[model samples]
Target: MTIAMGEKIFHHQLVYNDYAKLSRNFFNLGSLLEKIFKTTFLSKSGTQEGENTYMGNTGNKEIDVQGIFSSLPNVPTALFQSQCVVWKDEILICGGRPHNHHCYSYHTTKRKYKKICEYPHTIRIFGHVVVKCESDNNELTLLSFGGVDVSKYTLLMSYQSVWEKSRRKEKKKNEWRVVHHDTSFGTRKSNLTGASALIGGKNKDLLFVTYFPNKIDVIDMKTYHYVCGTGSNRLPIKSPYSLQNHCFVPLTSSNQTVVNHFLLIHKNLSLLIKYNEEDKKFCYESLPTCPSLATCDCYGFISFNDQIFFFGGYDASAMTEIDYIFIYAMKDRAWTQSKHSLPIPTRGCCPVLIGDGRFLHLVGGLAHHRTQAMHLATTVRAFDQVCFFFFFLSVIHLVII
Candidate 1:
């Protein structure tokens, strides 16, 4: 908060701005990509696990980072809770923080979110649970895990991202996976935190899981193993990728992605961790022995491309980081910003992404200022790009005269 520190912070931000422009410039971008691929840090410490980007251009240009999604009238709806995810072609939403008993889904085509599912009990536990639907072979599933509920302590571990997998494979026969950890939200199973996974299987095949205290485990229908996270000891306050909060649409892929590859966001640092499934060993299985505070929660999500894509958090100097979406080109080991800006100051709520690599759909989340109580936004923003050509020279002879 000092003048000298403020000046240093301003300089740091200005540097990032210059870097973003350089990374985005069309002429320099190619050379920049080359530099990214040859990054020295990548050679020494490589990150080829979860949430990798597709550097290979699909001929289709990247999404247009423009003022499109921010303008829609976010029509007021019933007091909702938690976040929303696409379910059976419907948007299924859960309540969070303060308890609420309404589990609903909205019909986009019809423009009305109706009641589809509901929690069996009240207390409206804040699972902060629920994620976008995933596919397994032919069966589509929603990998349901952690939430916050102190009432279910007797049933299972008290602090855990409860493990469950519901089938979104068949809409007609939609099924819910059994609650593995008896209590919906608690420690025995969760270790004072919750868990979610990137379902990167041919058909919901694998889950790269980050535990509360410490440890990132990989789970499937049959087997389980520690992929990446902490080894055996408990992580410090604010587990990996966990904090006082958590979701964003994981960059789910059918390609060679894994269940162990994940990034942990906390209040200060955004830890980017990856797993080597091929190198399964006692020492390798565990994260390079790190300090307790090393795993502390530093709020903000790392973008799919390793850009450390951040939104609003609890800091003013870091406020300079606000409104900017930087692309940390993993291939080059550098950061760049998009031509676009965040729709709003996304302090709370989930930045969960939902799409097939091509289109990124940003959905509901909580965004409140220092003065405001709280507000939920259901405005679904979709990102993609389009190339058009036009000429504006339709003039008559009178104009020339």
Candidate 2:
């Protein structure tokens, strides 16, 4: 019912531009008017009329106009070195510092967040690992492990599932239950926050917690007991592979009785270690070094589209943030850098793959701004790499050219 004067003018200009082909002067005026219209209202961050380049070399790239900082909702707190896990359609945000035990869950479909129950402990975890676990009863749970507890030891907490058959509630609240705690694998000995995951086992799932300086502990889910001894003595493999601050991912290529193989990524070494049941030994394969940097020290990685995407970490010497995004194609055994960078320089950020793995949603982390000191970043960014319509249009325009 009410239209602004600028809206009326824009409508008139659009109508005139549709008929501009009738005259030369009209075409020139219409083109000028269109430029004015775009500059006045349609302009956004990282959008240019010509080609744009950021970093990496993943073909013809453009700044994701819709994937800017303003497009995402801010986290409740500016958190870095926090734990993030994707459960079904929701994302769980766990403990982090400046020392607090608050937790949150973000509903991806609703695009809203709700503060969930806090962690069982009062202290904060420095570098924690959180994972989603499912049981044989078809129930889902969350397991959190590792991280420095300061005066206290490292703690292992699992969500107490309330999946009662008689209770017919659509939504249920879960609480963190202390499953295991020990001094040997705790904070005094190691700040065990390297890489972790819940792999499928014979009767239940097994959680593999990797400690610093190359050590792993396998915990049985059903009993919440260590499969072997505590600390470094519990690890299955005695190889000299020191899995310092690295990322551990499991690969399941077969449906056989044996469990999945483990992939470890430390500096200069990308090894795929699998357990040989018959020989009772661990087999390790050295993968090709994909890029020049040859490592992702404090970076984050997630398996997407059958590939591993490594992004967001800081360079140690200069203490500067990194914007490099690399992708390792599993089948092709090759690596390619993406031509786009983060919205800003970031480290300790969590990259979660959503919906068919075309878009990567980067969560909270530490960022360095030119005007201020390094601080926890509250901004979120989405990277849209699948240029479906743009690619088709560009191909058609190229043939015409």
Candidate 3:
């Protein structure tokens, strides 16, 4: 290549005052964390993997499996989002299912957990959501919204069921309030996939949710007034889409809250979609395929260091093991493997972004009951052991490869 006379310029790597500082600042390095970030990966049957994959902090602490249905010998579990968020030095986990109701906070530094408050449901089954509420002090308020009533035995109900249930419980009345303003847009059947973001709108932090049925909606959060639709002419489907799994991440064109771009993680296909909000449509980009990974069954995502991280979900073939975490870098427009693995085999568990920048945490999902017969915390255990054993064998083909 020839340069054009005196107008030519030589290109060189731009030098910064401190290479180490810039390197550390631009990438996610887990070396700074002070606690053990470990979780168990259970096949639907809850059997321990012959070899445990060590996770954050390297597996050297006590696990707080207290009061949970863990004593069951073998039980089928639900596939739902678990929000295990960390703020500063504390980790907070909120609502999931059966006995997974109520919200709790943990001190990573202390390595202990304490229940902060009961979530809207006592016998909570599903459909709990969390979002940044417009509080004066910036205290995050988790929304205890509608969910499936295992008791309903009839058809799935509308979004209003959440408001009705909360009213009856009347617990956390001071801390929790109704999103009374927006429920007026008629009943929506969307159970949310991930947490809603309080993104910048006419105001700095309006709430946005990726409802399960394949659509997006925004609410004033404070006023509970419908702000508008996001990313396209049609909204994504609402949650529990017995048909599809959907995920969303609000991207930036300017400051972080800028809504011109969105990162959508397809619920089950292991595809990450980029939507251009200004053009009012999704971009025509092929999804990066993780042959060993399946997106069709993932729980959540975390974006850090210019790449979005996808963690545990069921293996691609319905009958495979649910035991790994995958990472995809945006610069290369492809997916790769993460050095991390779930503490145990897990499917239908929730993955949440913790602290900020690079830290993330994983919590409860349905796991199988452990059994050796020779060794039982007791004999007549709970859940179902036979179903779980078959569930494990079904997925062995996928994992062996």
Per-candidate Cα lDDT values, in order, are 0.35, 0.52, 0.41
Of the candidates shown, which would achieve the greatest TM-score relative to the real structure? Answer: 2
- lDDT per residue, candidate 1, 249-315, as tens digits? 2332333333444444444434445444455321221222122223222223435533334434333
Q: After superposing candidate 1 on the true structure, give the runs of residues whose Cα lies further than 4 Å from its correct spot.
A: 1-66, 71-81, 87-89, 122-124, 131-140, 147-195, 200-206, 220-259, 267-309, 316-324, 352-359, 369-401
* Candidate 3 C-alpha lDDT tens digits along 292-342: 653355444666555665555654456543656666655566766544354
Pairs that collide, model 2: none
Q: Candidate 2's residue-wise lDDT over 1-401, tens digit each?
A: 22122112212233234433433344354334334433432233344653222321113432232222223455677666667766656667776654447777766655557776777665446666677765334345666666543533334434332223385434443556555453333435555655455464544466666666555556666666666533233333334445544667765332222364766666566767665433434556877665544434666566654466676676655567777777665666676676555655566767675554434455666655321111111111222222222333344567699
Model 1 RMSD to the real structure? 15.0
lDDT of 3 at 315: 49
Tell me the TM-score of model 1.
0.51
Ranking of all candidate structures by their lDDT, best first: 2, 3, 1
TM of each candidate vs. truth: 0.51, 0.65, 0.56
List candidate 3 stretches off by more than 4 Å.
Answer: 1-80, 122-127, 135-138, 148-174, 181-202, 228-245, 252-258, 267-289, 352-359, 369-401
Q: Candidate 2 overall Cα lDDT vs. reference?
A: 0.52
